[model samples]
Target: MKHSSAKEVEVRVKRTFLARKKPTNSLIDGQVKISIRFHQLKVRFKQLSVELNLFNNQSSDDRHIRCQRIGTRLHIFILIGSSIILALYSSLTQEIHHETILNPSETQYTTLAQVLGDCVVCPCSTFSVSHETFISIKPIYHHICSGDFVSSAWINFLLRSQFIDFVLYSDYHQQQQQQQQQQQQQQQQQQQQPQQQQQRQQQQQQKPPPPQQQRQQQPQQQRQQKPRQQQQQRRRQQQRQQKPPPQQQQPQQHQQQKQHQQQQVTTTTTTAQSVASAFWSFDNNALELYNSGLDATLSGSPIYTTSFAGYGAAISFTRSSTQYVYITPKVLPFNSRSFTIEAWIYPVSLSSSNDYGIFGQCQATSSNLCLYFIARNNKLLCGFYNNDIQGGTIITMSTWHHVACIYDLTTMTQQVWLDGSLDGSHSASAYNGLWGNTAIGATFQLGSASTFNGYIDNVRFEARAKNSTEILNDATLHVYYSFDGGSLTDNGPNGINATAYGSLSTTTGRVNQALQFSSGPYISYSYTPFYFLGISGSSFTIALWAKPTGSYAQQTILLVEQPSSWCVHYLVMTSTGQLVANCWIGSNIATNGPILSLNTWTHIAYTYSTTNGIRLYINGNQYSTTGSFTFSGSGVPMRFVLGGDRVVRQYM
Candidate 1:
């Protein structure tokens, strides 16, 4: 039989072989069957070869075919070789032609499913191919079947898409990690907060109890226990009251109670006593001046006596002669220890040699007495003349000034305060000396035996046996006046009928009354309208409270005119509410200080010295200037003026 197709040949070979194998088959038949089967096989093989040859002939120059045939020996080998060669050729051709798909399994297939996971079926496994599987199968597909170029293209697209998904996933995972960390930190903080709060509460609870709580507990216990003691005291008192029936004992008890009451009253009165009275002025009436006697002498201006001028007395002497003035009391008191000697004097001349103007002395002999006055070179000398240990320098121009000498025995120290400051001091073993007759002789004159000339007024001697602090605390020299023919009345020395000028009244405190002046002219014949509470030529402070009624043309409060050329004036209200001070030496107002306020009550103070010029203090503020003035020949023998001039009106 002639087989036309390869398919027919294959079929004929199979049928002939099966027919020969039946039961009752002849040798010839079998042989024929075998020959036919062999022929059919040969034919089928020839046809296959022809088809392959034709396929090869179509692309003769193709190296892929040559390679595929060269290695095709066994059937499995031909199968694998042909498949691999075809796949390789397909891949090469697709790549050359720029085809999208070359292989189905591999063929460099890139599909969304394969690159990520194989959603389509994977022929080799029960599960679908995952991204990892796809990656593994990729090289296999390149070496095996060649089909579905689209799968390869899709794989590449899926790989690009997978890269984008991977980036997003990574970002999301990082954000999740950060958020978790933050939450964990917050949780840790929350866990610690309760512990901190508990610690604070424990500290607050452990604080110490308040003072009020402790006090309250103690007081409550005391209050509960006090009632029983009170009840016992009441019972005792009742028993005593029922048994008190002795008349004589009652009288004695009554007298004792009265005496106890008196003692209590006395104690109360003493406790209530004031210290203000301790500073009261001394009794000036107790003092006496001995001017003409064996113990003392009198000289020029003998009219200036303590009897005549209340507290001031003066004695003058010339260069050729000597004079003295002394006081002797009827009773020589022994307790005259702490004393203050204040005097106002003008030195007419200063001696080159040491001069003595004895103020007070208890002298049985000349060398054994205590004395005080200006020494030679114008220094103040004070202490026992026999052995003078304590003294001070008084370097002032020859002029009139007020000087006060205070001696305190309790402290055993002598303090000489100039103006208000301590200028000098001395220490002594004892202040008490032998009591002798107090006297002033020719050697103890005012412008003493050495011819130092001047006038003196307002000499006050106070015996204060107490310490200085005690004496200052107890007594004050309240008032001082030089009665130069003026009535001793409550109204001041400037008379009531006087014009614009006013006067000091005695009705006020015992001290010297302040005189005020208005803006009109008031004249008087007697220049010494009010006695001048004079001062000696030394360091001194002049202070007074003054109020001006109106502005004045010329208002003079105090003036000093010397015999030769020295003059000083304290003028107030020369201008409205203004104070003027002028110091003249040798007929020239060498220094004219600035004026201060006068409208209101003002305390005006002037501290003057020959070495320090003049310092003015208004209400405690100091005033300074450049000009200097000095008394040249002798000190001024001038009287103080309240509202007018000393000698005459318009004396300036």
Candidate 2:
């Protein structure tokens, strides 16, 4: 009857319902279960409300605080949206740029600025970029990369091992052995064939004659057989007379020998066609003057002593027993195909029996052979793998001698030259098929192996055989006028003495003394040796020191002109005071050079070859080059005129 508030009434009703409940097992259990479930639901709702921060079913003041929190969250979300929109709008409107840098500076670049976009702003100077500019990469390698397993020493060790050496060279050795076995088998078969034929003939002759023929008409048969035998013998004699005599075959044999010689010459000439020449002046070092990359290494303290008569530097091997210069044969331009080796030697001691090496390449350490040039028995000797030639001229002790050894594979000849004269020569036709490979690992030595007790200088090597004229001249100095000793005598190896036609004086030269040319004067010499220069298209160098006080229109410094042809090679000064080197075969190749200062001593050098057309150098600096121009002429007579072209009346 007392109607309280809604809450009081609900609680009073729940209590009355629970108090009035009967003790029925099923109904009571159901009601209690429902009540527990209701309580659990209330607890779970409260927990969920707390987790969500909902603040539901609370007082006004609490709800007001919850409302304020919700409003603040909404304002934060709206501000985030506005910031995102502004960034998107700015990115869409702005032009994005990227940059690339190939080589970076060493300085470290650092920045603390931030960008909202995915990429950073490029520098002002850069408009485009590569991925490499921003991206970084690191490679992860296998463990073997940091080890020494791939070093050269390890590789060489493996190569030098016995197993590797056998594997590499076994095929070559087997091939050689098989060839020898085949040759022996062929010889044995030939011998056995002739023997077998002889045995068959003997067996046939040894058999007894028929018994019936012997008994029946022995005398009659003998008489008939005698006449038959006489007729057979006469027939045999006629056959012998019909055969050609040995004298008749001599011409054919001579023809074959000539053909063989021609083939040998052709072979050697082909080998000599390569123009590779090396020179070691021994002035101060063993460096190759030709730049052929054949520089040598000295061993065992060989002295770089004074030259002959103390003029220049020369290597002295007499001081030590095991001193020598070693040149690796692998770098030699030519092998045993053809070669020429020459050296100037001043022997201080002589031995009649002991062999002394001048410069040689031995076949091996055990076999002392294969291009072994030496001085033995007080004479020079040149040796090869198959044959050797010994010099006849005795080498005097303490005297300077120019020794040269030449082997021509084409001609099958070996020659030794002593002081530019032929000292020994012999046919090496035995080398036709017997010359084995002179292995590159062979020892190429100078002044060792029974030690050359001497001074050696001016050593030269060529891939081709040198003619007598070339042998008489220095390998490079074809023409040199020292103008010393108060005469126009040549200081070069070639003794082509010059004759001055007009007033010429000797003065202090760049070296010892120089030729001073006056107006209307020139020097002339025989040009026989120069014939090869034009025909063979070989290289030549002309160098001189000049002090000029004036310039003229086309003045000649040196000239080489063919008598009947217009094939002219001249070094001249043009009207513009510029130096010019011209070579005219049928066409012309001219190289213009810088003008030389007047009244100054200037060094001018001009070099010409078919490979290098024309090169002009002033004071050792190359001024100009015309690349390669091949020019050749008929082997006509040529005249060399110095300081003027007397034939054309052009003077410097």
TM-score for each candidate, following the candidate numbering: 0.33, 0.33
RMSD of each candidate?
51.6, 29.5
Clash pairs, candidate 2, are 98-128, 99-129, 264-410, 265-410, 268-410
For model 2, the stretches where C-alpha displacement exceeds 4 angstroms are: 1-275, 309-311, 333-336, 365-369, 429-448, 475-652
Question: What lDDT would candidate 2 get against the real structure?
Answer: 0.62
lDDT of each: 0.44, 0.62
lDDT by residue for model 1 (162-181), tens:
21111001223345666887
> In model 1, which regions exceed 4 Å deviation?
1-313, 317-329, 334-336, 341-387, 392-407, 414-424, 431-434, 441-460, 465-525, 528-652
- Give per-candidate clash totals: 39, 5
